[model samples]
Target chain A: MAGTVPLSRRNILTDRRRLVISVLGVAVSIGLILLLEGLWGGLRVQVSSYEENVGANLFVGEKGVRNFLGEVSAFDSSAVDELRRRPEVKAAWPVNTRFIVLDFHDRKQAAVLVGSVPGGMGGPWKIAEGRPVEADDEVVIDRALARQHGVGLGETFEILGRRFRVVGLSSGTRAWMLGYMFVSHDASAGLLRSPGTASFILVDSEDPAATARAVREELGLQPLSPDTVAENDRRLFAGIFGGPLNLMVIIAFAAGTLIIALAVYSMTVERLREYGIVKAMGARRGRIFRIMLGQTTALAALGFVVGFGFYLAASALITYALPQFWSHVSPAVVAGVALAAGLMGFIAAFVPARRVSRLDPASVYRG
Target chain B: MDDVAIRAERLEKVFGEGDVQVRAVRGIDLEVVRGQVALIMGPSGSGKTTLLSMLGAMLRPTSGKVELDGVDLARLPESRLPDFRATRFGFVFQDFNLLSSLSALENVQFALNLAGTTGRKSRERAEALLRGFGLGHRLSFRPEKLSGGEKQRVAISRALANEPSVILADEPTANLDSKIGHEIARLLRNAATEEGRSVVIVSHDTRLKDIADRVLWLEDGEFREINEMAVDPVCGMAVERKPETPHYQYEGQTYYFCSPEDRDEFAAEPTKFIPDRG
Candidate 1:
């Protein structure tokens, strides 16, 4: 009986080209999956992070609210005072959200207009430039929209064909459906032609459940906690973009798996004679299969490294081009991509390895 | 009696069935002892190669028994055949089926690896074998880079890597030039005689008669004793004859031929041939 030949590291490493190609295929597939997943995850995180920082204890809105961004809820302005009078409510304020077209430097751009009272709980914006919105005819624009429209502080911009002064620049705040502009209560009403009407009411209360109960009883309006508001935002986003993103991820995974499978299958077929010779030399079927799998795994590992590096460069390019669009390169995402790539390579090599193992040495030798 | 390294009893191989059936080997009974080179010679379709395959335990007989060293090969499972071939018998093909992807040394080492020999020892053994075959400098060259004779030599080294009890050569020298062919024959003969291994060669080349201890002539799926004159008809051409001789009188002339068919050929044209009275 002949003894077994232990696997050689030198042979495996020296055959770097095959290993690199296989790894690259796996890595590209996994990196694509990770990119898609990370993009989706980053969007979710941005949305939730924005909502959490808003400091809203409860949100008053219309029943069956579908689009929360820049949509009118038709709550009376007097309801704010009535809700604030409740025992559990510490403060209540009216919020006006509407869409308006802006004209700056002869360029027209559409923007979501948000209105809040001066010195109120939701009034002071996190300004990125210039001063906060204080005057009735003054507004603050998001940095992205500001740069796009070439508008600066103290510059007057026309909204809905009415001119208003640009008071400041704000950051980390955007409407769900459109780029945003922050304005005083009077200016927002003028833009919408609706006085004493707002989209929703924001409450700052220590106990949200109690305040929500109070608002429901006194004002006959449903009060939603910030968490519920975030949840609604998530549900809305998912309804609009969830199906396509999920399908994209699934298709990406499937494509990656198929690519790896084809690569491995072709490689196995090419090396069929070599495999037969090895088997004839007394290599057990299991060992041959393992060597093939190792080859695939090694290739996939190389691909993952290259793909991740490519993904990082691509993400950076995207971030540089569109600063507002979040494109994160997370280690977890890289690792997830690597794992997925490895698995794809493993699965892809499986059928071919089995075919190789089951091949008759006698027949191959005859051929 | 010495133990038979390979023994086949009434071996039969039939291909297909019904009208399309072809009986490859009718019934072959033979015994090969250790340290002897046996040659099976016949024209194509004479079941010479088929018999060799059956004896090497590479193919199963249709209705017969084959035993190697007292182990019944006919009853052995299909899965066990590879192990048996790897450990008990080595094979040399005419085309020198060396793997093109592997260097000559690696090709030999691959065989050692399959036999579960690994590490520095496998390399050392492979190097020794290659050096012994005078291929020390050609170890790194792949099959495509090597000459035909070198490839055949590497193949021979691979076959002998596991130190099997028997070596089966199927027209081993058919693809080589006369010089290389003779060299391969000498190597095979040396393996049998000096290394104490049984060698079974299937070839139509009668030049191998000198190296073979016994020559079995297969014709139409049956083995027949070959007359030395029949192997090489020209007199004094290093022919080895059987003890008995059969002669035929044609047109008042005595004709000497090996088989009945040769005698019939002579009968067809009696005046064109002279009688061999010796």
Candidate 2:
């Protein structure tokens, strides 16, 4: 009797049902892996996009800023002026961030309203519908928030027991804590009942490095770079989203691996007698091992294709529903999923290959 | 001339140690010549299959040497045994063990591929072998689709694909119908005589005796040359004679009764006691 024969593409394609099932299992597994990873990627991008649009060089808060969730920030208003007088500083402005429940047209919604200085970098209030806030009793609303609450330009809304007129509708402005709104410094101070004080100072500098040094020395405030701010937001999002995402990815991988492993294992066991026959015919053990491995890899590759298609459909649905938050599907993530699936197939084929290799050709001949 | 393709020297195979030891092949010596079809005939549990396995290099003898083509199979390393089997020996089974997944042609091609023949040449050779076995139209048919005779022919083609020196068939006709069984016996005999290849068949089927160049009888782990006068009068049983008894002949056929009881029975009713003399 010979050993096992070398695997060929023809052998794998010979059984269409096994091929389809193996591929499907791989696809589902890879798709799930891509989905979880994509969500993680999307959250990172969204946070960075928000921070980049804000144009804030340093955020000076009342310490333990993460605990407040932008509800309140207490710092002396004079710190802005002191930071502005330094040679490295180009301009400085006070910013007050407050989270409030607004009653608009009989609907109540949570919103983050930021108090910005007139003509300041901290303000992202580009008027798309009406105009920027001119009087203390007026405010600006983002497009998404206005649509959700059914409030438009020239409408008045009550926030934190104070009535404010919606003077403008803005684009590309979102508050990190809640949704989106913008108001003038005095109106925000009055609404929060804080007098002559702002939450944090936003600074633009002649040179960011020099300005960073000046703020540290003159104002006793730690300067946060734009990159650092984005990083902070990422960490914050991870704190909230990491556990569920990790759990989903781990479970999906395990299930996919087990499904492929068991399928391949059963198929190999069923083919054991055939393997003995082929081996007795002079097929090498290495060749037999390669054939089984090839089958597994082929199945995994097929599954990855289907899985990526599913991921694309899912991503389209999410992007359509939440257009404001940056959501995207990437090929790298899909490839990663496919790789994971292939690895699972390889692992699953290991034990079966061993069993085939150990089968004696003489047993088949014995009557 | 030492024309032996397979030679066993005092071969021993013990199943277990001490109390449970079953001496399957105990100190038996045999030699099978090239181009000869030797039939090892025995009842059940006679260790004929075990002896064949050792001679075929499928099993290692416990204490003695079995050689094929002057190469000591017992001393051959495990790694080299498969190569030895592939290039020097072929095997056929009673069950016609063809892989169900492959067509008859592919099954034969699989053997060629294992022997390192690949691509167009392998296919061409496999097709030629199948066509020679009268399976030209059934070349693409899987084992399940093929008839018993077809499957057996495919098995024979697979066995001969490597053109080995010897073919060891363990009860090749056991699973076939009488007609198919006779066909298989003829095929084995033809392969041995026409192809000039040594074939060793282990079978208790008396039908195979006609096709065999030599038939060796095995009983209680021992083998003896079966001559014309050693054949039993009833049931075609072959008897080993003691020194006291002489051989007997009747109607141009030789007969040997083991004892006086058997001789007395034969004397009273000779026609009823004797098998067909042919």
Candidate 3:
């Protein structure tokens, strides 16, 4: 008896050009899936950018406020002073935030306008250049947005028909469809025409649980930890974008499986007579199917390697071309794509295996 | 111990059904003892290949049974047929039937692998067989790279990989030139005489008669003795001397043909299509 031939590998490799084409086809689908997944990951990180990165341990919003992006959250500016007087509160900062479209240089940019008290906890956390906003008319905008529009320090942009000078540039402060712009609390209050009130009260306390209890029980406001606020914000965005992203991923997966199935099916059709010969020579159905699956698996594995390479390159190009749209490919994403590739191979095998199973070994004699 | 390697008792094979039915092979009985070479020669639709397929267990007979040694093959379950064929019978085809992707060595080794031989032993057996066939240097050559003769030789090496008790060849010389065809015929004969394996061949190539111990001529899905049949010089098919059978007078003798087309072909080139008996 002889050792088994690597039939699957050899069969696919027999036509080197076809194999390359098939791998590349599968690679494109895989790359698309990886790109979508990475973008989803970046969306998750971006949505929680303010709550995660701001120095506040807890956020005190108006009653019934559960999220930051879609929901309106506001409380009396006097709540900050009262929170500052509490023993559990280490520090309290009144911040007013709202979504506003800034029109400048013949373009409109959607942004989260944050009015943090000068030198307060909710101010620009990561200043890339210049100083944080101090004057009522000064603003700190996200660096990527400024660079995209060629806005620089000392340049003034109008928000809500009021002109404010760009004093500082912040990093990692953009969500999926909007960027963050920081200004003095009075500036946002004056620009939005809401006076003597704050959107949320940022609090850094010695015991966050104690402060949350005090704010909810005594001040009659909703007190949420930064993590809770971030999670709620993420859920809010996920609800908006999850369907489209998942549909794209599913389409990519189906495309990958189709590429693999098409390649294997054609190969099976071409070598059908040889398969009949093999059957006539006493190869069992199990053996024939193993060869088919082996061919598909080998093709998918090659495609995955090429796809990951494609993803890495595409991600770099995207980051360079559109700095705001970040794609993060984590280990979990890689593992998931690899598993999906294997599943594609498994699913692809059946189309051709069915053809082989129906083949008549007696056809070998016909030759 | 039984000396017969394969036995077919009133074996029949039919295709289609009802109005369109075709009786491909009808009530055929055959027995080939170990170390004997049996060559079945026939016209294109004469059921030679059909009978061969049944004998090799590649196709089940519509009726009766095929027995190898003392065991009836029909009694074996469908799942067991593959292993049974792999271990007991070796097949050769007109096309040489080598897997295009496999190298010569791997093609031969695949049979042994199918029969549960693996690793070093399989390699050694495949290597030895290819070497014995004078194909040592061609071990790594794919079928496309090999000449027709080399490919046929490789096919023979593959057939003998598991040292099967019977070797069944279909039109083994159909695609080969005369020189290579004779070489392949000798190989099949050697497998019978030297290795004591029963060799059954189905072919229209009259040259194969030189090596066969018994030659059976089949016509219209049934076997007919060569003495009761006349060979068509143009195509070498056995033609019964019936009233409607086409015949021509050549060199003061009557020659029979399976078709008027063959008769006309012979008439145009009588010397080119010389009857084997004449």
Candidate 4:
């Protein structure tokens, strides 16, 4: 069209200061949503990391035990021996896992305490420094937790009123709010007061499917694969934290929509005279609406670009400053955010477009 | 082709309802032939703007009809009105109304674009129009950068961009000094005379009468005979002579005032406000 000026672009660019402020407002809201979603993604991965990498083919728990967190499971220690005797099961070992709060220098830190037999299937897969737990008094804690609490090798921390020396600093062992603390089976048995029972029996077998079926039928206990156990752990974590995280994301989205609405509405109101002039010059309501939508979409897209950049920097800073939080920004997460921004743009354009539509074209003559 | 470019028959506009109804334009008949400049002069509360708006198809008449190019504008569907206005009528506003965001050339091109003209053709046409208006040197300047005269010239260029058959102007010279105001009036007149487009202007500026082929004086939503109306020497507002109207005898001529304040102001210094006497 001959008169198809880039009115939206020109209007937004007219006031550089206002445009920057509007973009930043939207960027902040978008950044917050991205951060929350990334944190949620990271949490899902971290919650199940240990079980996924524990090297056990299957996990034998109490009949009703669903996951390690928020669920208690303990079976007779004799079950481990019975499982090892089966030809389908190559080996079996008892492992006890529970939540415990450690007090170091009068500061309390929550952690998932894991105890297994020396050189067993269930242990810290990767040690960043020091050595694994070998003695009842020795413990391997997450490197992030150890560094956070200023605990080093040979330093003692009180767990369940018992003192234990830090033996190793394990890598990738911290969840968002909790870290992993590894100790000996005897030590965990003593700490949890279940010396004759195992929380779970770790099974190693070449024919894991046959062994799992045999264990379920003969042993009469719930046996789950490592992958199933890890997935259950993830579901448990999501069930606990999903509501709050989703609520925060929704609040961020609403804030972003309002920011776009405020900016576009104000711009439309300020340029109402020009709109009237255009209407008088034979520009239709549809054309005026297009101009408003153009401005809104431009604002949202710019904010998204800026917000994505902000998320990258902020996520890196969070990981560097507080190593416990792992923020993962995936392509799907970014695409979801882009779709949300587009929705925000459309919703924000409504109020301003309606206002322009109701205006009288003849009002231009009043000037 | 119709020699009468615009013919309005008993146009009426009533705002509000019942007791609060405002008859903005009432039972006014008007006609403008091709190449004619018709000026509608009135006081502040008169219906000149309303009539002009109706004539330009910007506002629907409460009753009666406005005919342009042998088609009754009031009968056209709402959806078709914008295109009709874009291709058949040009509007010049008191404030120039050039989009502040667009350059002088782009402002003109915007009109062509609205009329389904685009690309290089629109650009060349817009450029030629601006250059004809002596704004060739300021093609890229936004509205705020242009002087008042330059802005009005740009507005005129935009009005002429779609090659409309009729030009509807509301107070086109209200913001300019006498020199520039006369120049703008002459431009509108030339647009009518040289291009054979009929021009209808609603303004209080008496200077526009110099180029107007027909001058209509409106008061209280109705057009009165121009000879029966007096221009207030103080504010240049058209005032109808009535028993209660503010009147003063000045040099053997009876002058009517829209208000006593204007009458008092004029009574104090008749000579000072008498140069543009009507």
Candidate 5:
């Protein structure tokens, strides 16, 4: 043709179903990749909900326990009063986290129940619907989990065989893909069956390092700065999901490559004779090769766009349907997936282009 | 100007190796001059197409020299051969070999485009050629929608689009009916005489002979010209019998020569000679 676009594109477009199938194959692979990455970002955000939003500067935990991943640490809850006695401490509050399953309306959902002082230092900053934890049997739930569990204000559910009322709803309080339920120290202490124990203590001291050393030496509990706690939480999630995330990325790369390779290769085979004819007509091997690669490049690019579109739709659905579980779509993440898809397109067409290059011009005579 | 557009000296093409080796074209000596259409006719497996491929630089000769415009095609670099063929030679296949997705005008434009013609120039040149070939009304029609003769005419227009010095056609009239085939042959004849191109047609269809300037009958990897005139082995021209022509005798056979100069050259080195058989 005299046009800029090769006839390969027309041939592919002429068979509308094949073009759509090829585009969809690449789009679905890219969509899956974006979904996994978004979920990973969401996991990081929700897992560090406490340390990120908490106003305290220092945290005191068991000497050997890591940060609050699954909240599997416990210590004497009296550390709060002991830390408060220090002249450098502005205020100190003991915090507790426990993974508990709530039985509601004949269904069970897992939750991470975090308890802090009612109003002093370590509690939810924003409550969307209803009042804060006002009594021993009242709990604050993230709006996302509340919507998911169909429980809102004045709705009561059983936690640890005791009935508790959902009196408040907070936004963005999620951990480990589950909801974070906030309660008073006393109520959570009762839930843990250790009335005076706390998993950690948050201190709002201006000089966090000095206060941390003082708390560590006097109380024998390791006091960590907030940054260290947040970093530890991020690294912890990386350790937990790193292998699976790597595997998913590899699968995404392979799926995209194979889809392009198979599509281009089969098209090349189907038009092998046509390619020979072009060769005989004084077309260089590179010309024919470009036509084949051009097809794959067009397909991959279209697929990438479609995949990105799918991700946008999915992200919107996630935002609307699941408010507590946030799946972030970062620019870097999108660029990385697009680059991978482009690389797959470039590499995938190599074999088929090679086939086109090696085709003998005399083969057209065979027809 | 050089009249000889394509000249082959003992051209040969072999397929495979060892036990399965087959010689497709065996030592055929031929030449087609400008403003002339030379046709090669043979049954299947006669190496007609194989010989055409070597002559057109589409395939490498196993041994021998095929030259186009004094450039030895056998010695041409692989990278330069495509440009050489595109710029210097055109090809027409029997099946019309038009890209089915392209319109008739676009088909001619593709040939011009491959030789680096584009934009308005490409379109204008393609239009002029197709219009000249009486295909002005079918410029936008694709091959599948056109009749066999129309498709072949479009193919001929494509061959002439680049204004190549020579057109190498493989079975140019094999697919058309007798009437359409003759029309295609006449088109080829005009391409050579009116357009002043050298055309080489390889086909099994003898219907092309009425318009052919010279015809070669190929069989068993070798060929003999069907023309009554004899080709001067030294000067590479079909020499007619005349009182002014010189003659040479070798092994009880009388050879009429184009000139005394050619007669002297052949008489000195007869062992290197490749002569036409009766």
Candidate 6:
């Protein structure tokens, strides 16, 4: 019997063009999967950016607000003091969320408006390259939005027909698909034109979990931890868009498996005579089957390496071309895809291998 | 009595069944000893190849018995026949049947590995055999690159790689020209005479009769005549078989004694017998 590896390599490589096309199929499938996963990763990071950067222990949100980043949750500002009166709460700050159109340097773009108390846990934690927002006419913007509009410190930008000087720049504070423009608490209320209402309350506490429970019971406001809020927002985002992404991944995998199957099955049929000759030389059914499987497995392995390389090249291209369009593929994802390729190869060769096993060695003598 | 290497009794083979049935072989009895070249001569569909397959344990007879060195091949399980073929008999096909994916050396080594010789030793043995057949330069060539004669030589090397005692060839020279065909015939005859193996060739090529020790004529799945021997039984002189003259009988058997004097001497003293008789 022929050694399976050498025979498989020779057969698959006999037609180099065919092997390359099959590898390309696998690469496209895996690259699509990784792209979707990377987008999902970017979204997860975006949704929880504020809670993560605020360093807040507890968030007192409105009753029906789905999330803190994208939802409009307005309640009386008086809840701040009430929450701060609790022993576990060290400090409480009022904050609100609103979508407002901003005009800067004659260029207008819609931006998410965040109203917060400056120098408090509700505002930007640290400046990237500028001073913190101080006066009522001052605003702090994310570095991404600043770079997008070419704005810098001491530059005045209009928000909802009102102008505020850009005093500070913050990094990695952008929300999911929306960047923020932070202002003083009064300025936020002034922008909303709602006198004494805020969207949510940020709190610092000795024990956030215990305070959250107490605040929920005493004030009837859902006091959520940073991690809990981040998780809820991520779940909501997935519910709205994840279904389509998952379907795309599944379709790509199925198409890849089918291509591999057709290619391998045709290969086996073409070599059926050779298989018969080997059998006549006393190769058993299992041995012949292994030879077929060997070719499929080898193709899959080569395809996996090409697929991973494709993913890397695509990721680099995406980063270089679209600086703000984020994507990342973890090592575990690559391993999972490689394993999936191996499984696809095995399944693809099964029917053809069975055909080989049923072949009669006596057919080798036929005319 | 000659030491029998292969004995087939009433071998019968039928293909398909009912209206589509074809009786390929019909109860042909045969025996060929070691160091002898036996040729089954017939046209196509005469069951010569089928009988050869049955004798080599490649095809199970429909209703008959084939014993190789005293083991009833029909009684052996089907699963064991591959090992039997690998270790006990060698087969050469009309098409060469060398695996196209393998080189000549790989083909020969593959056969040796199946017969339980493996590693460097099996490779060396394959190279030695191919080299001995003067195919050393062509050992690395595939079937497509080699000529018809070289392909047959490679097939012959594969057949002999296992060192089996019996070689069953189906039209071994069917693909070669006349000169190459005669050269292949010489190779088969050498396998029997020089290596002391029983060689059986099924072919329509009548030129092989010159080198065959016993020619069995097959027609319509049955033997029309058999044991066309050239060796005289009484005086041990080589003579062509003729129906009349120098023929004698003892007990119930007839003999070709080569000469009238030898026949008369055998008739006068029936007890005195030569030990070296085929």
Candidate with the greatest DockQ versus the true structure: 3
Q: Per-residue CA lDDT of candidate 5, range A94-203, in tens?
A: 88888877775777777888887788767787889898996889899888888887887998877787778888999878875678888888888888898889888888
- Give stretches of model 3 more than 4 Å off: A1-3, B228-247, B250-266, B269-278
RMSD of each: 7.0, 6.8, 2.2, 2.6, 10.3, 11.0
Looking at model 4, the pairs that clash are: A2-B113, A2-B117, A2-B118, A3-B110, A3-B113
DockQ sort, best first: 3, 4, 5, 2, 1, 6
Q: Candidate 4: DockQ?
A: 0.65
lDDT of 1 at A222: 74
Q: lDDT for each of the candidates?
A: 0.72, 0.74, 0.89, 0.89, 0.82, 0.79
Runs with alpha carbons beyond 4 Å of true place in candidate 4 = A1-3, A85-91, B228-278
Interface RMSD of each: 4.1, 4.5, 1.7, 1.9, 2.1, 2.9
Per-model TM-score, in order, reads 0.79, 0.80, 0.96, 0.94, 0.86, 0.79
The deviation in Å at residue A34 for candidate 3 is: 0.4
Write the number of the candidate with greater TM-score, choosing between 1 and 2: 2
True contacts kept of each: 0.26, 0.39, 0.90, 0.79, 0.47, 0.26
Model 2 chain A is weakest, by summed lDDT over 10 consecutive residues, at: A1-10
Cα lDDT of model 4 by residue, A222-327, tens digit: 8888888888988888889999999999999999999999999998899999898888888888888788889999999999999998899999999888888999
Best by lDDT: 3
Tens-place lDDT digits, model 4, residues B115-195: 999888899999999999898999999999999999999999988888899999988998798799989999999999999
| Candidate 5 all-Cα RMSD | 10.3
lDDT string for model 2 (A291-323, tens) is: 677766666767777888877777677655654
* Model with the higher TM-score, candidate 5 or 6: 5
Pick out the ten consecutive residues of candidate 6 chain B with the lowest summed lDDT.
B231-240
Clashing pairs in 3: A1-B117, A1-B122, A2-B112, A2-B122
- Model 1: residue A305 alpha-carbon error in angstroms: 2.4
